[model samples]
Target: MSVPILKQGDVLIASIQSALTDRDLLQLKDELAEKVGRLRSRGVVIDVTALDVMDSFATRTIRSIAAATRLRGAETVVVGIQPEVAIALVELGLTLDGIATALDLEEGLDVLVEVMEARRRDR
Candidate 1:
């Protein structure tokens, strides 16, 4: 299934509504990367609240999505990772290194704002 990616000001929010296949994940990564550049987005929020399970491939793809968007100058935040999913990822030794995470969409956006503000201060 195709994920719905919404643009909120300078941020792109991809809310995964259901379980996705590897192909779907890759497509999401590609689409978000392209949108980050095309829309001049400064941040991205990926909401995985609905997903009950996340395998290594899903975890890796999500990480790659963040990495790919970062290369396009957007900071990515993953929000709403279920408790069970988080535990499974840790058990599998799949880490979401170099990525920011939040409890929900609101918190995720706040994180993005802080990150953007920090960048502005640095500049």
Candidate 2:
């Protein structure tokens, strides 16, 4: 199933509130990219708090989404990662390397705001 994507100001928030299959994640990436471009959003916050695990496929999908969003001129922040999931990801040697993360949805939004502000200043 596709996740819910919300637009708040210039930011797009996508909450993955259920366990998603590979196909679902692929759909999510497509939807998010489309929404970002259509809405002209400057940032994206993906809330993954409900996810119990962070497998390699899921991790890669997130990375891909972030990269694609960046190319579309939006910053992506992933929030609500459980402690166990973080530990498992590290143990599996998947560091989610270049993706930005936050503790929760509120923090994620703040991070996105900060990133957008920085971009504005740089430009």
Query: Over the stretch 1-123, how does candidate 1's per-residue lDDT look in tens digits?
Result: 999999999999999999999999999999999999999999999999999999989988988888888888989999999999899888999879878999999999999999888877987
TM-score (C-alpha) between model 2 and the true structure: 0.96
Quality of model 2 by C-alpha lDDT: 0.93
Candidate with best TM-score? 2
lDDT of each: 0.93, 0.93
